[model samples]
Target: MSTIFGIPTPALYGQILIGLINGSFYALLSLGLAVIFGLLRVINFAHGAQYMLGAFVAYLLLNYLGINYWLALIVAPLVVGAVAVVIERTMLSRLYGVDHLYGLLLTFGLALILEGAFRHWFGAAGQPYAAPSQLSGGVNLGFMFLPIYRGWVVVASLVICIGTWLLIEKTQLGAYLRAATENATLVQAFGVNVPLLLTLTYGLGAALAAFAGVLAAPIYQVSPLMGTNLIIVVFAVVVVGGMGSILGAIITGYVLGILEGLTKVFYPEASSIVIFVIMAIVLLVRPAGLFGREE
Candidate 1:
């Protein structure tokens, strides 16, 4: 059994893989956050709850309606995203032009409400969600065993991240979005319907969160609290990556994920705090985040 830094090779590789998996989730979630914050200027504290909702929706569809994972993957996000649109239209839309803190508080309250409601209905226990039959197996690499579902997660996350980047950076619609973010009054004068754009952006962000939750259903127990724990780490990733920089969020997520994995191998005790420690360093060095422009 060959060892790297006194750790068994298999163990080391396994941890790295786990890190990559985690990184994928972080990237997806943080990307959504960046999109919302960048344009809407609303820090969506309900994002985690929206994510939990996605998993719960998937679970309900599968257990009650006989909808399979494949269908749930498509339906769950749309359902949650539509709900997000309603929330934005009826409630969040009113908070515009006010203090950003008001938006944060509103979303935080929404998150608590959602979590409490789910807890009341489902209790605190985690529900089991099996991976699809096609993704239930593993491939034995010479050095390590790779689970197909996890590999799929990494690939899917990368694809989504890249596609979103292209949409925001290279497309005409993206140009319109950027323009609205910069000068909404000017865009509105040009007949761009800025309010609709804001609502859609928020909906898209929530959908991204829910999509990640669906991906996570098989790996983690689908519980009301699942997104609660991960959201904090994701916020840290956002701060380190720069809140509005799409590419920065994606890159930072994977980098920090691998760093956390390596930390687990080298110093187990610091693994949990590694991301935050880096976050603190990044803050001190660049208060606007690694990619954010200084205000």
Candidate 2:
């Protein structure tokens, strides 16, 4: 039996797969945070609440109505996006002219309110969501058995992440977004409808968070507090990755996730602090992040 680093190679590969899945979620969630920070200049504290909302929405859709997992994946994000847009159009829009602190506080309040509401109703208990029929099984790979759903998650998220990166890095639309972030008034003078753009950006960010939420629902319980903890870890990912570039954020997320998973295999005690420790090092070595340009 061959082994790597004193651990069985098979077990190492299995943990790597799990790491990839976790990394996928990290990538999606951090991408949203990066986009929001880049375009809006606001640290959206309500992002976690939106994540929780996505899981709950999918859960309710199944139990209350006849909505299945396939449709819920599409619907959950849209619904969460709509909510974000509404918040942007109403309350968030008013803060653009105010201090960034105000925006952060407002969003934090919203997060607490939403989380409290969900807890009040759901009683802090979690509900289970079944995996879709198409992705509920596993495949034998001779060396190991691969869970179909887990592989699907890793592949699907990778596609989505790469697709988003390409859209932002290569498209004309993304150019406008980048330009508007620097000088919104100038962009608006050209009749680009900057307000609409902001709303749409928030929607996209919320949709990203919701997508991660839906992906996780089948694996984890659909509980109000789920997002609370997840978002903190994701925030560390964003800090380490820097909120400057989409590609940077996505790449950093997956890498850090894998590192954390590997640490758990070798030294379980360090798994939790590894991310924060990396964050501290990144800040000291390159305050602008690996892919970020110095301001």
Candidate 3:
């Protein structure tokens, strides 16, 4: 019977939870984008397609191979990441050191092709992906009930995000990746395989996207258009956080998600555009983004 700011306690808490859940997805997706742009300087427009591909891979594993969610979680990203590797090696490699628009166009074309192909084969309707038995329930937290799977999503995303940040900021390989981006010729001179590093970086970005897709499969319907629905918002999050800023992407995603959720509670009509509005303001005020460095 209690309320906070005139809203019922349960309702307010529920929206906040929803926001956190949404933030999890945003963070995962934008993290991938940030990594790719930061290291490779490529604007990966095919990222959403890669995400959808991961979910579809999981779905196929479940239906055809009888694989469970846990196994698919490990397998889907590897498969999608491998595919990304191939794409980079065969096609994307040639386009480096050119205008970013070229990479964007190539990826955009790939996205269209991927979406079209999946739509043709699977139809536009969403398919259900049931949560595993281990995560098939909810727990009451006095003020609200939290789904076990949803809680798992937030935890998993946080772990992955933190792990990724540490890998890029703390590890030796990360140092090489940063070095390669800044000066590939110099890094290569030191016996590093710059080309291989670039390929792997792209694969890692795709793997991140795929991992997020696997997490999303049970929460949202597994549909070809699923990625299309969320990619724009994720891109907006990256922009607001600052392009190529690993820390910024992670933080901004959660913040924007919570803000969006609060907006839904306070003003339903404005909820959808709130993030974009903030993105526009950020762009005008600091084109480099809240966390991005002005170049």
In model 3, what is the error at residue 145, expressed in angstroms?
0.6
Off by over 4 Å in 3: none
Q: What is the lDDT of residue 287 in candidate 1?
A: 89
Candidate 2 structure quality by residue, lDDT tens digits, 6-26: 998778878787778888888
In terms of lDDT, model 2 sits at 0.88
Q: Could you report the Cα RMSD, in angstroms, for every candidate shown?
A: 0.9, 1.3, 0.9
1-295 in candidate 3: lDDT tens per residue?
9988899988888898889989998999999999898877888989999999999999999999999999999999999999999999998988887988899899999999999999999999999999999999999987799999999999999999999999999999999988987888999999999899999999999999999999999999899998877898998998899975788899999999999999999999999999999999999999999998878
List per-prediction Cα lDDT, in the order shown: 0.92, 0.88, 0.92
Instruction: Pick the winner on TM-score between candidates 1 and 2.
Output: 1
Clashes of each: 0, 0, 0
Candidate 1 lands at a TM-score of 0.98
Whole-model lDDT, candidate 3? Answer: 0.92
| Weakest lDDT window of 10 consecutive positions for candidate 1 | 286-295
